[model samples]
Target chain A: MSTAAIAALTAILLVGIASTVIGIVGHRARRTSDFLVASRNVGAGANAGAISGEYLSAASFLGIAGLVLSDGVDALWYPVGFTAGYLSLLLFVAAPLRRSGAYTVPDFAEVRLRSRGLRLVCTAFVLVIGWLYLLPQLQGAGLTVATVTGLPAWTGELGAGIVIVLSVMFGGMRSATFVQAFQYWLKLTAVTLPVIVALVYFLGSGHTYDRPAPPSFPERTTVDVHTGVTLQAGQDVTFTAAGRIDGRDVAPTEPQTWTAGSRHVVGEGTDLTFPAGSAVPVVAGGPVADDEWLLPLSGADPHQLLGIYSLIIATFLGTMGLPHVLVRFYTNPDGRAARRSAVYVLAMIGVFYLLVTLLGALSRFYTPQLLVGGQTDAAVLLLPTAVLGSGTAGAVLGGIVAAGAWAAFLSTSSGLVVSLAGVLSTDVLRGKRLSNFRFATVLAGAAPVALALGVTQLDFTETVALAFAVAASTFCPLLVLGVWWRGLTAKGAIAGVLAGGILAAGAVGVSLAGIAGTGVLGVLLYRPAIVSVPVAFATMIVVSVLTARERPTDVDAVMLRLHAPERLGLSRDAVSGRDRAELDEPAPDERAAGPA
Target chain B: MSTIEERRADTGTVYERVQAGPEFADLRRRLRRFVFPMSAAFLVWYLAYVLLASYAPEFMATKVAGNINVGIVVGLLQFVSTFAITTVYVRFANRHIDPAAERIRQQIEGPAR
Candidate 1:
């Protein structure tokens, strides 16, 4: 096996063993006296770390860099929206959500609207969003492993899936908020070290960025195309080729000419050695030159403006609706702490994303071959060895990057599974047993594992944005109106959620099914948040107004609970509302004695 | 609906009374007054950045410094504004919102705090 592969394997194994051990230990403590107390002890800084850990998924770690490498400066919007989304969350929902005393998104729906039916619908939506979000993380894992190990993607995917399942099953998610917190620091150290080192190297290497042109190989470099790709050649280039080029075999010693503006198809496993200072041949549909890359809205599609708006709306508003995100707020001691936690989250993740963007930029000079191969997602993983060569130091650094990527996958996937299983065990199965929770966990991780293994690999960040669109469409309206507007009825919320969920999820369904057409129709269909968000808001407001009589008479009390200070003693959490395992599922007999 | 009403009667009129009073109104008003205007302000700021990014590509590509452009600066500022707003909001919450809420809670829920 290759040194890069060994380092990556060791990294994955280390993260797996550590997390599972932590999970087992955390579960044992929670089964006894320590769980309930641990919930309230989560400090703002540490909780923020945990939140950031779970929040920075495969998309933030790998996808942003890849998109930036491929699409140019316009891609920075993804990370910006991602970080800025927290600002809205902090302003509008942070304190109120914690004050509302609802742990999960579904729990909040039931708490605010006082509707079981709405809760059930929300349960379904949570599962949908969770699954949609989980798919990309799993796919990202497969991509990372396949890029490193050069093994079939299924092997890496299955390995990551097993680790995630095992960790969550051992009860790592609910009790050990600190484990996720540790993951954040681990990820930070992992990615940060390589990036800082690489940045220094790039600066000292005396490379200049003044020329507005396609990135050329800095040295005599040989790149193997693992998959068939159409290259958009910028200038006439002569390359020694082995394997099929334009459907004919070129011997290793023979030099082949690729004309400028000509689309050249290089078949799988073709090795092309390009001499230094030659203009790079980018993959078809990628930005070919630095000038086109540096400029925003220079995307190939005519409707890119609308697409950016839709993307902004999805990510900016979507943070509040994430299931795993809100569950962490319950761990905060009070509403104030929750708000504080959010601020810290913004700070922590903001720094992390800035670093991530830097990595994306640095990948330009170090690993531009990824641009040709159209697997820019592997840019971070391969950058170390690409710069440092395939020696001991490079392998060790590569291992760190690979481990960080694994942590991203493991933390986010496990968090999703925990929340999904939280909904499933409590709402779906109607059971209080730990076994039921374990079964729910299995179902949660297993379904996405199957889907991730089965589906075609997509641009990781874009797929994640689609999940955000679904969230923004459905739950953004629900949380916003339910907190701010008194007229928000259960039936109205149900209508809005259904309308938004169906429309946004329908769009995801269309795109995932590969029916996405180009231009206006396609961009709108792909990132439908701008349309779906407004439609959901209007539907809820109109329905709420029309059915004013159906409004719950106890709106004042619920509002008081939601908006009032935790110090006021009016905003006590219902036993059924929290994700606390001691108070979780099949309510304790004494609390269950209370009449509806 | 009747079942919910029945449960409300059992809990009695404390919450409704609290919700109706001026203290609670003032508290809610204070929060809404801060968050609404602030949310709008930052969103507009963010929107300006996004719009300039999309419509004014030539402008966005203008280099402000060595290897830095208008687009990159504005994007980084989005980060700065977010952190600044967070700090300012926390200060506002601590000074303006918390003490009043604490006073009201002490008045109603006793001096346990």
Candidate 2:
């Protein structure tokens, strides 16, 4: 095995061991009163770490750098939108959500609306969003494992799926706080250390990207084609090929020429070697010149402005709507602690994304070969070996990065699995028994692995963004309206959530089916938030106004519950859905455990 | 777990009365004064930044100092604005929102604690 692969494998194993050891050591969710105040009484800072850990996921860790490499400055908005999401959460959702005393998103729906139907609908969306989000993470794991270990993608998916099921069943309900908080620091170090090293090395090397041509090979380079790519060259490139090129195979001894402005199809598993100074030929969609790449809106074709706006709306509003994200807020002890945790989260994730952005810019100099194969998602994974020359130190750094990527997948999938299990055990299965949660974890973890195994063409970050878009359309309206508006009724929420969910999911379906055509309409469909989000809010408001008589007479009481400060002695004890049945009421004394 | 008298004793009017009172009014107004305008302002600021990056590539690409382009600096300022807003709001909450809310809490919890 290559040293890079061996180091990466070892690093992944070590992270797994450390996470398990910490989780076992920190199992303290033991007493009822401790949890009557909150789960584990998780401090604001530690809860912030856990929130950032789960929130970062595959999209932030690997997808941000990939997008920046492929699309340039405009793509930096993904991370920006990601961090700014917390602002809305802080301003509006955080304190109110924590104060609502609901166990899950579905629980919040029931508590606010007093309708089982609304709760069920919210449960449906949570499952859809959770599975949609889970699939891409598993697919990303497959991609990284295939790149580093050269194993088939299914093994990665299967292996990750099993690890998540076992760990979540054993550690998730017991010691989740310690494991998730540790992961955030591990992920930060994983991305930051390599970034600092590469920065020093790159400055001394004096490489510049302002030239008129595409980035060139600094040395003789060979790129492995894991997926078929159509190379679009702006300048002439000559190479020796060992696999199918335009349906014609030549041995490694044969030299090939790809003339400028011409397209050549390189089949999967082909290895092409480029001589030094050979201009890089980008894949079909990306810009081939450094000049085109360094500017904004150059890489995205058709409707660049509309696309950017749609992406902006999805990420900024979609953040608080994510099911996993909302559950993290519930871990905070009180409404005040929830708000404080959000601020800490903003700083933590913001710092991490800045380092991610720097690495993406650096990948232009170090791992330019990724542009050729259209596998830029590997940019962060392959960067250390590329910059530091694949030696012992480089291999160790590569291992750390690979391990970090595994950590991203592991932490995120477990969070999703635990969430899905919460909903399933309480609402779908027998009841909220420990055995039911364990059984549901296996189901939740397996379904996505099964889907990821069948789906091969998934783009790592864009798929996650699609899930975010759906969440933005559905729950962004529900929560924002539910918290701030008293006119919202069960009928209104159901209609609005259904309308938004269907429209958003339809847009995703059309785009994934490759029929979202190349026109203004296509841009609208591919990035639908600019259109769907307004429709959702409008539907909720209109339907809500029409059904105002159906509004729960207890609206003021619920609003007071959501908005009142914790010191007011009004809020009920938070019931974690992991162990408690959804409709089961907390004992009156526990509810009256109010101010004291 | 619930009976008609227990439901009657639910004391729903107390919450309604408290929610209707002047201190609660001040509390709600205080929170809205900070959050609504601040949320709108930051969202508008972020939207403006996004729109500029989309519409005006040349302006974004203009260099400022030492290879740092206007685009990157503006991007970094998004970070700055986010952090700055967080700091400002935390201060606002500690000084303005929390104190008034605390006053109301003491009134509501009188002899109840």
Interface RMSD of each: 4.4, 3.5
The lowest-lDDT stretch of 10 consecutive residues in candidate 1 chain A is: A587-596
Writing each residue's lDDT as its tens digit, candidate 2 over B7-109 gives: 3476587788878989888888888899899878888888777677677878988877644778778878888798889878888887888777777666655
Predicted candidate 2 versus true structure: per-residue lDDT over A45-150, tens digit per residue: 8888888888888888898898888787777878888878777777777777777877677878888999999988888889888998998888878887887878
Alpha-carbon local distance difference test for all models: 0.81, 0.79
lDDT of 1 at A522: 88
TM-scores of the candidates in the order shown: 0.92, 0.92
Best by DockQ: 2
| Number of backbone collisions per candidate | 0, 0
Q: After superposition, how far is residue B101 of candidate 2 from its true place, in Å?
A: 2.1
Residue A385 displacement (Å), model 2:
1.0
Off by over 4 Å in 2: A24-40, A240-256, A262-271, A513-516, A574-596, B1-10, B111-113
For candidate 1, the iRMS in Å is 4.4
